[model samples]
Every structure is written in structure tokens, then in C-alpha cells.
Target: MIFTIAHKEFRSLFSAPSTWLILGVLQFIFAWFFLARLDAYLQVQTQLAMVANAPGATVSVVAPLFGTLALVMMMLIPLFTMRLLAEERRNQTLALLLAAPISSGQIVLGKFLSMVIFNICIIACSTIMLSILGLGTRLDFGLLLTNALGLLLLTACYTVLGLYLSALTKQPIVAAMSAIALSFGMWLIDVGSSDSGSAMRALSPSAHAQSLNSGFIFSTDLLFFALFIGAFLFLTIRRVNNNRLYA
Candidate 1:
């Protein structure tokens, strides 16, 4: 049942021109960034090649590229999230969904997972670009995998937050803006600490991701991500239930 709703939402996203426009812009940003990073990386590689001791691809250059991607995903998700619930409410389709045999949790999960899967596809596409990073360099596969997991965990948190915000508002624009603001606020909170404020970063999903970025995948880090994703999923379900009550 949830899968059905996810399929519908995923298909609907392609039907919307604005979604395609945003996606095109995302592609441009990624391409531009990848080229720039690779240019600098190739230069650094040449310089390091002069020395016998330097590794082919330094973590310094590679980690920042993935880090940049993590931040970009943080910004891009709200664009997809806005229409999830807001469009349904605006078109008066939500009532139909609510009236269906499906639980509010199912509706919420379906929409949320659809966006999550869509995002996964977007990130999956980047593997080709990241593979380019590995072609001539001795990149650590395990480190890359760890970073990918970190990004996935972070995306889960952002998607649920956006889905919940979309469910709260009837206006799609308002939902998009609110979700972006909220996600950006969380990100800025981490930025303000500059990796020095463990208290602040520890609680922030962005911070947990930075931990994985450093290749230290602690049990606490895994627990934090699991809790983060679960907490937002629970909140979104609760929010959807509240909407049903208010209706």
C-alpha cells in the first residue's frame, strides 16, 4: 500500500516541470563542482607525484568533495518535499487519501519513502562521478562507503523533516521555504560550532555525518543516525495522525 503511494508520488514528480527544472539545475551544480574539484585534484596529484612518499589521492581533496555533496543534498531535498503533502492538500486529494483504507502513517511513509528513493537515485548517479575520482587514484573504498552511509542517514533526517513540514501546510511554496529554512538552520548550527562544540554537533545530524567523514564510525554514531531517522519518521507519522484528527 505504501509502495503504491510512493510510486504515484514518484511518477507525479516527473510530471511536474518545476521538478525537472530543479533537477537540471542540480546536475549543473554537480558537474561544475566535480570538474573544479578534479582539476585541483589532478594538479595536486601531479605535485605529489614529484615526491615518492605522497599517496595518489589525498583524503584532503576527496573528503571535501563528498562533504560538498552532503551540503548540496541538504539544500535540494526541500524542493522535492514541498509538493509531497502540500500538493495533495491543495488539490483536495489528501482527503481522498485519508478516506482510503490506508492509515495516515502509510500515507506519510509512502510519500516520505518516495522522496527518499528519488534522492537515493540522485546520489547513486554521483557514483559515476565519484568513480572518476577513483580511476587514477588509490581511493579507499571503505571510507567512501562510510561517507555514503553517512550521507544516507543525513538524507533520511532531512526527508522526514521536509515531509512533516509539507504535511503541515497547504501552500507548497510555504512548505518548501519552511523545510529549507529548517534544514539550513540545522546545518548552520553545525557550521557555527566549527567542529569545536561537541555539544552542538553531537546532537546535529550534520555533526554525526562529520564523524563518519573522519572515518571514525563509532557505535554511538550509528546509534545516533538510527535514532535520528527513527525519531523523524515517528514525528512525521504523529503529525499525519494529528492532521486526520483535525480534519
Candidate 2:
């Protein structure tokens, strides 16, 4: 049943023209940035060869692309997630799900899974540009793997938060705006940090994601995203369960 709902949700996303448009535009931007970074790397190759243990194309071009995609995901995830529950509620469809035999957890998990799957596709598309560097240079597969992992974890965080915010209101645009505002706020916390242990920085997903982006994986960073995603999903379940209770 959970798989059924998740599959339905995934297909429903593609049913909209905007989903295709977003993916197309995102890939185009990623390619443009990639070519620019590659061109810059080429221009500096001679200078870098004279330096000791200079960074490679993987570091100079590929890694930064993933980092850029992280910021893009921050802005775009809410648009995909805004309609998850908010649209259902707005269209008077949430009531059917609430009254069904399925638990709120199943419903929430299903929706979250669908969003994760969709975003994984987005990450994969962005990573394709990174993979192209292997044709001309020795790519750092380990670094690429870590960067992809970091983006996936960050996407999970954004999806959970967006889903929770989507549950709070029936207005999809309101949910999108609120989610974007909150995400951008946390991103600011990461940007303003001077200390690694600062409270605000610790709460920012981007702070942890940066470590993985640099190919350094810390257990604490992994735990932070796990707890962050779990807490939000739990809260979403509670919110939807309350709606079921009232119904």
C-alpha cells in the first residue's frame, strides 16, 4: 500500500508540465555552469601544473558544481513538495486519505519517498555533468560519491521540511513561500557562521553538507541530518494524525 501511494505520487508529479520544465531548465543551467567551470579550469591548467599538488579538474570543476546544485535544490525543492499535501487538502482529497485504512505514517512516508525519488533523479541529472569530466581527466570517484551523498542527504532534509510545511496549510503557494523562506534562513545561518560549533551553524544543513562536499564525512554530520529528517517526518505524521482524529 505504501508503495502504491508512492508510485502514484511519483507518476502524478510527471503528469504536470511544470515538472518537465523545471528539470529541463535546471539541467541547462547546470550545463552552462559546468562549461564555464571547465573553461576556467582549462585556462588555469598551466599555472596549476607549476604548483605543488594542485587541485585537479574533479576538485576545481565537479565538486563545485555539486555545491552549486545544493543551493539550487534549496530554492527548487519547495516548488516540488508544496503540492504534496497542500494540494490534496486544497482539492478536498486529503480527507479520503485520512479516512482510508492507511496510517498517517504510511501516507507521509509514501509522499516523502516519492519526493526523494524525484530529487534523486535531479541529483543524477546534475551529476551527469560531473561524470563527463572523466572523459578528459582522472576523476575522483570517491569525492564524487561523497558529494552525491551529501546532496541526497540535504535533499531529504529539504523534502521533509517542505512536506511538514505543506501539511500546515491548504495553500500550495503559501507552503512554497514559507518553506523557501525557512530554508533560505537556515542557509543564512550557515553563511554567517564564524565558528564550527556555533549553535545556529550546527542547526544548518548546509554546514554539515559542506563537510561531505569536501569529501570529509563526519559521523556527527550524518547524525544531524538523520535526526533532522526524522523529527520533521514525525511532526508531519502527528499533524496528519490530528486531522484524522478530527475527521
Top-lDDT candidate index = 2
The sequence of per-residue lDDT tens digits that candidate 1 reaches over residues 28-109 is 8887887887788777776787888775453655567678888998888887888888888889988888889999888888
- Per-model C-alpha RMSD: 2.0, 0.9
Task: TM-score for candidate 2, please give it.
Answer: 0.98
After superposition, candidate 1 runs with Cα above 4 Å error: 50-58, 194-197
**TM-score computed on alpha carbons, candidate 1:** 0.91
Q: What's model 1's lDDT at 152?
A: 78
Mind giving the per-residue lDDT tens digits that candidate 2 earns over 42-81? 9999999999999998888888989899999999999999
lDDT of each: 0.80, 0.93
Report the CA-based lDDT of candidate 1 relative to the real structure.
0.80
Candidate 1: clashing pairs of residues: none
Candidate No. with top TM-score:
2
